[model samples]
Structure formats: structure tokens, C-alpha cells
Target: MNLKKHYLITMIAILILFFSIFSILTKLFLNKGFLSIEKKYKDTQINIIQTLLENEKYSLSNIVLENSYWNEIYNAVENKNIDWINNNLVYYFSSQYDYDFIKILDKDKTPIINYSKYDIDLNINKIDIINSTFKNSQQYTDLVNIDSNFYIISSSPIFDGLGNKAPSGYMIIADRIDTSKLENLIKKIYNFESLTFLSNKNIYFNIKYSTYIPLKNNNNETLGFIKIIPKKDNIKDYFYKIHIIFLIIFFIMLLIFIYFMNRIFETINSKIKSTVHQIDLISKGNYNIKLNSNTNIEEFDMLSNSVNNLSKTIKEKIDENNKNYIEIIEAIMVSLEVKDSYTVGHSHRVANYSKKIAKKLNLKNIREIEVAALIHDIGKLGIPESILNKPERLTDDEFDIIKTHPEKGYKILEKISYMDNIKHIVRFHHERIDGKGYPLGFKGNDIPLESKIIAVADAFDAMTSDRCYRSKFNIDQAVDILNENKGSQFDPTIVDCFIEVLNEDMEFKKSFAL
Candidate 1:
């Protein structure tokens, strides 16, 4: 699933599980509390009953225990024609127990005494409770339902000084047991804002419980269930606080994971860039550059492998062609040299000088300088091999034809796309800064740097090397000639670069031999 849905389902399921467990635990706790309250209620009732009994209130206990006491007392009262009995025993029971109503009855079921919150009566139907009591005892308890109100009637027969514990009428005390002492006890059990609503299946708990209190019965026996619910609004805010805590933790962990993933990807990308740069260089014929691929990464290994393979083929092809192309240039230059071996390595010398001066000038860019030096003498292609090999001076027509070689060579390499830049160098190598050189006769900075490089190299080699027409100048003569013509025939800017190269006494130091 998508991330949102995935997190949504997982978190929702977790929340649901959490709430379910919370609800179950809440129910378990409340049930224990309800049970405890029930037991407490029962215990309190038992305590009250036990206390009254211990205080010699057996008259009331006997009423609760006997059945025929009501009728015996009612009959005795009726026969005596008493309005109300003057016994201190039932009155004491009433005073001690908070009984709202108290009464006595004769054997004929007449009321001996009766008292209410505001009234008194001398008659009651003891026959209504005639046979309900503990066996053979003149005591009884009858549940009376009147006007939809429920009350308990406890009746007991009186006794005389004689050893006969026979029935002698009865006394009754009525008290309301709807007191809310049980609820007060529950309040004590719950936390400050907690409560309960009784229902069949659902319970709500307001607090994460500090303790659980089960209900109790009137006999001090335990009841196992209690319902707890919140009575205030702060509980939801508690969960909100919890959500904030969990959310912060989750995002922090997520950010950490993302950061590590980014670091790993960055490392991978860096490695890939190195591989691409190496492959790109090899593609463009820069075999001298190293792969340095490290060979551990698979793509790097592949790139390194590809470059090595390509270098093998390129090395073979370049090896195959190098002798042929160099021989052709050498053969042509040799025609000049054969006419006058004073220019034995003239082409080679010019190429070296061009490259050196370019390097010294900080025009150290490789490809352009290479192509420029390689074809700097390409214009001589049109020079007649016979006269170029001539040992003596040429006619004016032949000299004009000789000067036309630069323009002619420009046209020769002009159509070859890879060699197009070579033509400019070929065309301007003979041009002079004094506006006196043939072909374009371009002056100063108007000459391209490539052309200027070839110009310096070509002039230096020509002056130092002997020709069929004249003796070669010495190194100092060549240097003086160049210095004298620095701004007039050669660009002084490139001249400085040329001076540095000559001072280096580079690889092609020997002058052309005649």
C-alpha cells in the first residue's frame, strides 16, 4: 500500500487494540470495585445488625426472627383495650436505629403502639405477617409493598419475667435502608474526577487507576465487579499529549533513516560520476588519462574494462597510422632536406617548437594545440616536390608559387571537420605582424593564437636551418633575428612564450643539417 494508507492502517489498528485493552482493563477494575462496594454494603448492614443485637436489642431481632409475634401482640393489645403500649424496649430500639416508624401488636393482631414522623396509630394488621418467621419463633420479617414503595417489617414477640419464653405480643421497628453510604464509599475508592454509570455492557474509566476497589454486600462479603467512568474532560487531553510524544519520536527516527539513505546514495552517485568522467575521456581519445576505477563497484569495473578495451584498439590503430602519416610529412620535408639536408628534421623541429611555445604561454590546452602543431606545415602540400627539393634559389614565379602554399594548404584541410581548425594555423603561420608577410599579411593580435604559435615555431626553425639558397644562421643569429622582428614580423606576446621555449633547449634542439 501507499505510505499514507500503510501508516494509517497500522496506527489505526494499534490505536484500536490499545483502546480495546484499555476498555477491558477498565472493566476488570470497575467490576472489582463494584464487587467490593457490594461486599462493603453487605458488611455495613451486618455490622449495624450485629451492633444492635450486641446492645440487647433482641426484641427487634426476635421480631425479625419470628412469624406469629405480630398476631400475639395485636390480640393482647386488643383485649387490654390499650391505645398504645408504654414499653421502653421498642422505644429504645426506635431511638437507637433511626426508625421513622415504630409499632407493637397483640395476639389478636391489634396495634399496641404506633409512631410516624408526625402521627401515631393504635392498630395494624399483624395477620398480614402471621406465618413468616424463623421456625417456631415469635419473630418475623415481611417485605411489604404499599403504593409501589417497599419496606421491611421486623417484628418480635415480648417476654415476661417467668422462664417461659412464650410469645407476649410483639414489637416492630421500621427503618429506611436507602442511605447512600455505598456511593460515598465508592467516591473514596475512585480518583478525584472519577465516577460510574451503571449499564449492562459498557464501562468508561476516567483515570489510569491508582488502585481498584471492588463492591461488597451487607454481610461484609466481597462482590467482584465495579464500573468506572470519567466525570470530567481532561482525559482526552491526556491522549493528545501521548500522541504528540509518539509523533515526535516517529519523525525523528524517520529523519535519521532518510539521512543515512541519502549518504549512501551520495556515495554511489560520486562513484558513478568518476566512472562517467573516465569513460567520457576514453571516448574522446584521451587514453593517457587513468581509470583509477578502484574496480570494486561493478559499474566502475565495467567502465574500467570498457576503457582498457577501447585503448587497446585505439593504440593499435594509432600505432598503425603513426608511421605512415609521419613518413609522408617527413618525405615531403626531406624533399626540402634532400635539396638541402640542412633542414633534415625541419618539420619535426617546427612541431616541437610550436607545442613548447604554446605550453610555455600557458596555452597548455591539449587537443587544439596538438591539431595546430600537427598540420602547421600542411600548406606545403601544394609546393612542387621537384622545386621544393631544389638545391638552389627559385625563379620569381616559383617563389610566388612557394608563398601560395599556405593558402593552398588551408583549402586542403578546410573541408575535413576534425582538421578544420588546422587550416587557420596553416594559413597564418607565414603572416607577419609588420603587415609585410604574404598570404593574409595579417598583423598583430588579428592573428589567431594557433596561427601565432605556428608562426613563432616556423620562423625560428627556418632561420636556424640552412636552405639550398643560403647558409643556416647560428643559434644567436636566429635569436637576434627573432628579437629584432618580435613586434614587426612575429607577435611579441607569442615571442615571449617562444623565448622561454628556446631557453629550455627542448627535445628538438639540433638545427637542420645541410
Candidate 2:
């Protein structure tokens, strides 16, 4: 991806990371805090209900104790007055106290008075259970389950009103915790959404934060559960709304920040591209071109100024080097002319002929061929003057010495940096098309094309020029010699181009006239 896309993606990633961390924090601390508050509130409400239930049990125990301590209750039990109990006692207990069941038992645990509003089982077995339950404590006030219904049952020993004698009987009173009572208690506590009594299943909780209150009997056996679901908390809803608003504001802020950052980076990117374009021009040797200096960024402005200075310095150095290179070539040519005056005309005419042949052949490096031809015999400086100026045919040993000139020329030109391109041409000019006649016998196609062109030019110039040994051959004889030597001594294509140059260009042909 490009820098802009990468930067945008990175910014978006950071934004997402920030929100993720915020969400985790909310879950860990804030949401947990709300949950903790809800738990405490539910615990408080459950405690209130539990306290009210305990108070109801205490009130029931007080009523049982007061009734059992009365002298009339003791006389009624002792005299066996069922009619008196029915007329007075039942009306007082049931009408005033809202008692669900009333039972009077003698000291021997035989029931005397048994009155119930809902036909509750007052059987012998149940009576035995109630007696057994209060035999140890002598008093009972607690919840009990009868026929799958919950009730508050209270029991006390009956005695005389004045001086308490041995207890003559026991009095028991119970108040049922029916649906209306539970509903009234809940309505007094808080406005709840719903109330449900659950069975033995342990998993009773549902959505909307329901509170499960288990109802157990005096024996601690679970009878049922009361589930209270309160209305949703307005404060919690308010907190959630605030957090949503904050998230929206944060998102808007992030977008605005990214937009400004994108604008800034766009300016920087434009400046960078401008700077790179100028540097590219400099790399391609457009030394005269200047970098844009008006980029407002300080670093880019400084870089532009530095590159401009560097370009000026490089262009000056290159111009100075070119001037020194021309002087070096002139000095080498003067030295070669001093060594052998005949080579002055011979090298110049050979360079002229090589240029014409290169142009006729449509070769790109015509100047390179001319340079190699001019320096093709520079290695003759290493040859003895006696060998170079010999009037007669050279013996085998002397011909071997003459053949070393091409290698010597390459070695001399290799030291000049600008002349490195033409050094190979100078070294391989004498190599034949068939891999013969060279210091290193490079064959056709292996020889540089500039070297082939110079080879044909050098031969034509040498054959047409007068030497100390013999008079020079005419132009036609030189051309015939080139045709005969094609593919063996001279490259056939270069020979043909040279012959074509001779036929077409009168100036080049006049230079080869005897």
C-alpha cells in the first residue's frame, strides 16, 4: 500500500484499539460497578422482606403466648367446654387476629378445640408432629408447609391467668401466607414488575435482574421460591446514554483529527514528490536542472539548496575534466607524431575513413570508431624506431614485434577514464574475422563493431599511403585488396561499407588517392 493508505489504516486501527480498550474498561469497572449496585439493592430489598416476615413470626408468637397464659383458656381446657370455646374463643382469635387455624390441646396432648377456616388437616398424626416439635423448646413460632401451602405456626403452653400452676394445655395459632398476603407485602415494599413462586428447580433466574427468595419451613426444607423483578434502573439507563454520546463525540473528534492529519501529509507528500523528481533529473545527468527551492518545509528547502549547490559543483568539475581530456589527447597525438611523422597523416586519414565507413553502415558509435583509429597505432611508441620505419619487408621476429602494438595501445588508453569505452576497440582492431591475426584471437561477432570498422579503415589508409619500402597502391588496387581479404583479414560487412563510402563520398575517396 502507498503511504496515504497505510497511514489511514494505521489511524483507523489506533481508533479501534482505543475504543476497544474503553469498552473493556467499562465492562471491568463501570458495568461491574452497576452490577454491584444492583446486587446490593436486591440484597437490601430481600433483607427488608425477610425482616417483615420475622416480625410477623414474632407477632404470631406473642399472640399465642398471651392466649395460652389466660386463666379462661386454662379453665376451658380443664372443664372440657367445647361450646364456650366455640362461642367466645374462636370469635376472639379468628375475627381479631385473622388466624387461619386454632387448636387447643390438653396436657396429655389430646385436642380439645380444632377450628380451621380452610379445612386444614388437624389429624392425630399432624398433632403428634406439632407436639413433638414443641416438646423440647416448650414454645414454637415459625413457618410451616401444609398441603404445599406456607403458614406461620406458633405454639405455647397454657397456664392460669393469676398464679401460674403447672401448664394444663397447649394453644396453637397459625396464619397462612396466602397469595393476597404476599401480594400486599410486595406492594408495600416497592412497585415490582412481576412476582412468581418457583418449585424445586434451582435455576430460576431470568432476564431483567430477577431476585429469587426461597421460602423454607421450620425444618429448613425448601417449599417454594419468591421471584421479584423490579423495574429497570433509570440511573443505569442515563449512564448508558451518556456513554453512547461520548462515543459519538470521540468518533467525530477522531475523524476531524484524521482529516487534518491527511491534509498535512498531503502537503508533505507533494513536496516529497517534487524533491524526488528533481533528484531523478540529476541522476540522469541533467546537471543544469535546479531543484524546486520554494517548498515551504524547512528540511526540503535545505535539501533543494544543497542539491543545487552539488549540481553546480559537479557540472564545473565535468567541464574541467573534458578540457583536460582534450589536452591529454592532443599531447598524445603530438608525441606520436614526434615518434614517427608519417603516422600523423596516416592516423588522421584512418580516423577520417573510419568515420565515413561507420556513418555509411549506420553504426551509432561513429565518434568512438574515429577515436580508436586515431589511437590505433599509439602503441607503436613502444615499437623500436628501426622496426616502425623499416624500408624492407620485416622478418618473422620483427613482424612479431609489430603485432604487439594493439595490446600496447589498449594498455595506454585503459588508464584514461573517458577513453575506457574505446580501449577494447583499440585492443581488438587487428583481430581477423576468422579468429586469427590478434594478440588474443577473438573471432567475428566477438570483435567489437567499432574495432571492425577501424580495422577496414586502417588497412585502406595504409595500402593507399606511400611507405619507405614501396610506393603506395592506387585506390582501385586498395579496394581490390580489401575485397580479396573479406571475412579473413577484414570484416565483410565493414569492407562493403568502406567500399560503398569510397563510391558515394568523393571527399573520402580523394583522401585515399595515390
Candidate 3:
């Protein structure tokens, strides 16, 4: 009787261990599977929203272009016919076309006629005409934020009767994006819980579970975001039900074969427990962990070998991924260089100069600083190549468009979570030390140290490199310029460090042909 009791106790312990291991593995697998399914669904919904927004912008552009290209409208605006303007542009177009706001601006961008369906005032002075220049006939669309309200704005130049010469003025149309309109559209198309349009300030709310997609203009600058809050579903409950059913079957099988299967079950359970522990270590980023299989069971040995191989494979893959990431960054730099002849090899030189300055200052994370310097002008990709390579000085409107590149670069790099530390450096590299720099006018110490370092390097490279508008400056001339604007335009310390670095490395200076 005592022997039978001992056997029963041993069988019960084995069964408990088996059930515990099974439950953990099942839970891990099920959770991963369900999460993947949820991600796919959410991604699909976000893509739909992006497509819908693009289509809306396209439609708005078409509407504005139709009115702007009319010869009669162009002649009326040029001749300053008040009766023609009021009857056709103000009353007829505003009422029949159903635009929220319609305005005609002269060559100076001053409004000739302003009409609004809503109470919000229109600020024509703040409107950007970078993409709507008379130099080209292309229609431009932008998401404009005025007084905390967003609008889809389209601008097209009004050409003369001959339709061949420069435009006399611009015809502008805007459609407001209100909460009711957004909610109605979401319900009609997505059938999701709700869609929220968020500004940069409110983007952090419910970030983990919600889908936050950046809304970009025709220039690819991020204007705002579309946040999708998905309706909750029973994915977890379904997986839980499946797990319970499997556990029941497992418990029944163990009970039926308790006496006969005791020794075999103990061996299998021991091997599985060891495997699980090693896998857990690997999951926790300990790729060095390994398992040993001496059970003499073919299946157990194969499983052990597979786990070891997986660890080795994972390590190799991680190394390869790191290498590939760096290569990709370099490739992007090369592509940017290709876009503007003046900036060819500009990023590489800036990176080299930044690294030297960083070393002189004994800054931490020097590699990150170098990488940021290399891609400092990545946002220039969004700027029109014509503007980037334009030989003449930029107009106020053109410079405003140029100033948007830093923010554009920030948006692009922020998408890569691992690049968070360096992204700010890329964004603020153009910032002035005196709080006069663009996108965000951060002052003095508010600018990141890495950005300060890159700013000096970027300026040095620009001065030394030949541009479309001017020839390259000699070493003394470039250094003098840096010394001249040290405190106001650049961090004085970083500028001094770079100057010292250039003096110390004769070979590097020779490479620049200084």
C-alpha cells in the first residue's frame, strides 16, 4: 500500500510540472499570434485613411485648377473689373462651387477678393507660394493650419489670355477639415470606433494601442497626424478558449496513461523545462545561452541542436542587420548628393568634420554625432531640386520652403525608433545659437550639443564647397567667416574646437585642398 501511494504521489508531481510548462509555452505562442493579426488589421485601416486623404487632396486640386485656368477669369482679374469679379468669382463660384474659402491674389500675393463660408478669417500673407510660382504651371496643394483650424488648400496661377506668359495672380481654394466632417467620413468608410486628428502636442495620447500616421503635404512635410482608435475585439478570449480546450485534452491523456507513462513523461518534462529556460534567456537578449541534451532520445537531441543553431543564427542576423542599417544610411546620403550637384560628397565631408570636432570636445556617442552630420541635410530631399540648385538668391517665400527641410528630416528619421537620439541633431543642425533658427526657434543651451557640433561642421563644409551661386572659399576666408559669426550663428565653443581640429590635422586639411 505504501509503495502504491509513493507511485501515485510521484505521478501527480510529474503531471503538475508538465501542465505548467505546457501552459507557459501555449500562452507565449498564442499572444504573439494574436498580436500579429491585430497589427495587420490596424495597418490596413491606416493605409485606407492615407489613400482617402490623398484622393481628397487630388480632387481639391482639380477643382482649383479648373477655375484658375479660365481665360475670362484671368482677364477680369487683370482688368480689375469689379462687376465681373463680384458676379463671377465672388457670388457664382463661391455659392455654386461650394468651397469653404475662395480668394484671388495679385502678383504680390495681396487678396483681390476674399470669400469664406465660415467665420474664420483668412490670412493670405501667411500663405506659401513656393510650389505655386509663375515659373511653373503645376498646381500645388497644402494642409494649412490657421487659428488652430486645418484646411486643405489648393493654389494655381492664373495665366493670361494667350495662356503662354507668366501668371497675373493666383486663384486659391480651401476646404476646412472640421470634427463633424472627419467623424462622418470615418463612419461611412472605415466603420472604426473613431478617428482623431491630432496636432504635434497631442500625439502622445494612447500611442501604444492607437495607430498614429503622419499627414504629409505635397512637399512631404508632416503637417499633422491621423490617429485611429480601433474598436476592441474578442481576440484574447478566443485564444483563451482554445488554450482551455487543449489543456483539458492534455490532462485527460496524462490521467489515462499515468502508471505506464511515468518514467517517459519525467524524462520528456525535464528536457522541455531545460529547453524553455534557455529559450527564455535568449528571449531576454542573452544569445549566449545554450542547452545540453544527454537524454539519448532522438527527438530531444534534435530539439537541443535546433535551439543552439537558432541562437547562432540570431546572433549572425543581428550583426548583419546592423551592417545593413549603416549601409542604408550611407546610400541615402549618396542619393541626396545625386539630387544636387553642388552638394555632391557634401555629407561625407560634414561627417568627417563633425567626427573630428566631436573628438576634440571629447563628446560621448561620437558615432551618433557623425551619423547625424552625414544626414543633416536629408530633409533637403523634400525641397524642390530647382530650389536647391537655384543660382540666384532665394525669395522670402522660397526661403520659407527651404527652412522646412530640418523639420522634414526630423519626421523622416523619427520613424526609426533606434535613431531617436540622433534625429534631433539632424533636425536642429541648422539652428542658430541666438534663438533665431527655424522650424523651432530653440535658444542657446536649448539646442542639443550634438546639433551644435554638426552646425559648425555643416557651415564649414558649405563655405568650402563650390555652389551654383558662388565659388568655394579658401581656408582662411571660411575660418574668418566662422570667427565672425561665432556667438550669434553657431556655438562658439564648437566653432573654436573645429578651428583647432582643422589646424591640428594638416593631412585632413590637405584633403579639402585648403
Candidate 4:
């Protein structure tokens, strides 16, 4: 992937993972924290209900104790005034105090009288319970379930109002838990909404924010359970709301970050492409093409400026080197003209003909062929002036010496690094397409294209020019000689192209007008 897409995907993935983990961790933290808060609230409500129930039991016990201390009740119990006991005690306590049941028992633990407001079954085994629980105290209180009804029971011993006599009987009073004031206290004062009385069997193990208060007899037996539920906690909902808000904010931030990142990448990518385009143009010899180095990015702008500077410097150096190379070539030509003036003219005509043929063939870098043609006979300078400008035909040995010029020209141009490509063209210019000519006898396609063009131009110039052997041939004779030797001594395509150039090209005809 490109920089923009790769960076975008990576950042998106990282942010998503971070948010996912953050969300999970936040949820877990909230759950743990809320669980602790709910538990504390539940415990607090349970403690309040326990206090309310205890207060109720205490109030009932106090009522029983006051009634037990009445001398009238004590005297009545002593004299066995059953009617007085029934009318005064039962009617007074039951009607005024909302007691579910009132019971009077003798010191021997025999029940003397029992009155129930609701006429519930009084099958309680009170003697054993009273004796077992009152062995240590004269007053007692307990929560009991009788006939499927839960009650808070309080018992105290009857005594003389003078405070001198022992107790005559025991007074026990009870209030059913359902009709008791505890429920109203829990609901009104404590602000609890749900209160339920459940038998031990009906009590559930799991209840939402519900507290269980057990009602037990004096024997510590659980008779029933009280369930109280408080209001639902809204903190979890609030926390989630806040978490959602944070997530939305984080997502918006991520989008903003991506937008800015895309802009940054686009800027960087555009600058790089612009720099690369300028460098490509320079590589293709368009050194005059300038790069815009004013991009906002510092490093890329610096690189662009550096590239522009390098291109300018290289172009300047190349121009200076080219001028020096032309001066050297001219100086060499002057020396060659001093040795054999004819050969110097011959080199110039060959160079002109090679340029025309090269252009006619649509060859690339026509300047390279022109340069190679100009210097193709540079090695002839090594030959004696007698052989170079001889007025007669050369012997076999002298011809052999003349043929060594191409190799000498290769040596002369080899030391110049800029002429490396055309040096082989100079060495192989005398080679024939039939493998009959040259130092290495290279055949046909084995010869460089520039060398083949120079060979045709050289032969044409030699045929038309005055030579040590004979007078120069006429234009028609020269054309016929080139056509006759097309595939043997010269590249046929280049020879044909040169003949067409001589006939059709106005520049060539004017330059060589006979």
C-alpha cells in the first residue's frame, strides 16, 4: 500500500483497538464500582429495617412489662377474677394497643386466660418456650410464626403495684408482623418501596437489591423472612451515558486526525512526484527543466533545490567539456592538414556525407555519427606523408600500412572518456559487411551501426576524391560503384540511403554540387 492508505489503516486499527480495550475496561470498572455501591446501600437498608423491627419488639415488650406491673392485674390473677381479667386486660390491650393476642399464664406456666383479636388458633406450646427463654430474665421478646402468620411477641411477669410482692402471672402480648407499624416506618421514613413477608421456604436466594430479615422464635428457629427492596440505582445508567459521550468524542477526534493526516500525506506525495518529474526530465537531457522547490515540506523542498542545483552544475560542466573537446578535435585536424591536406579535406567531406546519410536513415544521435566520421581517418596521421599523399598506386606493403590507420585512430580516441561509445566506430569503420575488410574482419550485423554508416561515407568519398592511385570517379560512376559493392564492402541499407540522399536531398546536392 501507499503511504496514505497504509498509515490510515494502521492508525485506524490502533485507535479502534485502543477504544475497544478502553470501553471494556471502563465497563468492568463501572460494574465493579457499582456492585460495591449497591451492596453498601442494600446493607444500609437492611440495617435500618432491622433497627425498625427491633424497636417494634421493644415497644411491645415495654407494653407487656407495664401491664404486668399493674397491681389490679396482679390481684385479679391472685384472686382468680377471670371476668375482670377478660374484660379489663383483654379488651383494653387488644382494642387500644392493636395486639393480635393477649395471654395470661400462672407462675407454674399454666395459661390462665388467652384472648385473640382475630380468633386465630391458639395451639402454641408456650410453657416450655417461656420456661426455656425466661430462665435468665423476667421479660422477653421474640418474633414467632403461628398458623402461618408472623408475630412479634413480648412477655413479662405480673407484679404487685406496691412493689413488695412477687409476680403472680405472666402477661404476653403479640402484634402480627403484617399489621405492625414496621412496614409503614420502612416505607414512609426509610423511603423503601417494596416490603414483603415470605416464609422460609418461599424466600428466594437471589433478589434484586432486596434484603431479607428473618423472623425466628426464642429457639432461634427461622419461621419466615422479610424482604425489603429499595430504589434502583441510576449510577450505572449515568456511567454508560457518559461513556457513550466519550466514545463519540473520541471518534470525532479520530476522524479529524485522519483528515489532517491525509492532507499531510497528499502534500508529501505531491512534492515527491514533482521532484521525481524534474529529475526524470534532467536524466533525459532536459537540464533546462527547473523544479519548483517551494513546497511547504522542508526536507522535500531541500531535496528539490539540491536536484536543481546539481542539474545546473552538471549542464555547465558538460558545456565546458564539449567546448574543450571541439577545440581538441580542431587542433588534431590542423595537424592532419599539415601532414596531408587532401586527407583533411577528405575527412570533412566524409563527415558531411555521413551526416546526410544518417539523417536520411532516421538514425538516432546523428551527432555521434558525424563525430565518428570526422575522426575515422585520424590514424592516417601515423602513416608516412609519402604513402598518404603518394602521386601513384601503392604497393601491397604500402596498402597494408595504410589499412592500419583505423586501429591507430581507435587508440587516439580511447583516452577520452566522452568518446568511448564512438571509439569502436572509428576502429571498425574500415570493416566490410562481407567480413573481407578491417583489423578484426567483423561481418554484417557484428559492426556498429555508426561504423557501418561511416564505412559507406568513407568509401563514397574515397571513390569521388582524387587519390594517390587515380583521378576521382564521377557522380554516376561513384553511385554505380556503391550499388555494385552494396552487400560486400558496405551496409546495403546505408548505401541505398546515401544514394537517395545524394539524389533527393537539396542540402546534400548543394554542398556537393559537381
The global C-alpha lDDT for each of the candidates, from Candidate 1 onward, is: 0.52, 0.71, 0.73, 0.71
lDDT of 3: 0.73
True-vs-predicted CA distance for residue 371, candidate 1, Å: 4.3
Clashing pairs in 3: none
Model 3, span 85-106: residue lDDT tens: 8897777656875678877777
Across 257-305, the per-residue lDDT of candidate 2 in tens digits comes to 4666655555644664665566566645677988777866544565566
Ranking by TM-score: 3, 4, 2, 1
Model 2 misplaced stretches (Cα beyond 4 Å): 1-12, 127-129, 133-137, 199-209, 234-253, 256-514
Q: Model 1: per-residue lDDT, tens digit, 1-514?
A: 9986786566556544544553344334434433443344333333322222222222234334432324444444545545334444445556665565676565544666667653433134433543442234455554343332223456555544331655556556654322243355333322334333232234343324312333332233432323333344223333344334434433443343344443444454465466556645554556576665573544445445544654454445444334433443344454435443434566666777777776777765644665556556555544545446667788898789789978876765553443556668778878888778879778777777787778877887788766777877887788788889888888888887677656676544453323
lDDT of 1: 0.52
Model 3 clash count equals 0
Between prediction 1 and prediction 3, which has the larger TM-score? 3
Ranking by lDDT: 3, 2, 4, 1
Per-candidate total of colliding backbone pairs? 65, 0, 0, 0
List CA RMSD, all candidates.
Answer: 55.9, 52.1, 11.1, 54.5
Query: Least lDDT summed over 10 consecutive residues: which range in candidate 3?
Result: 233-242
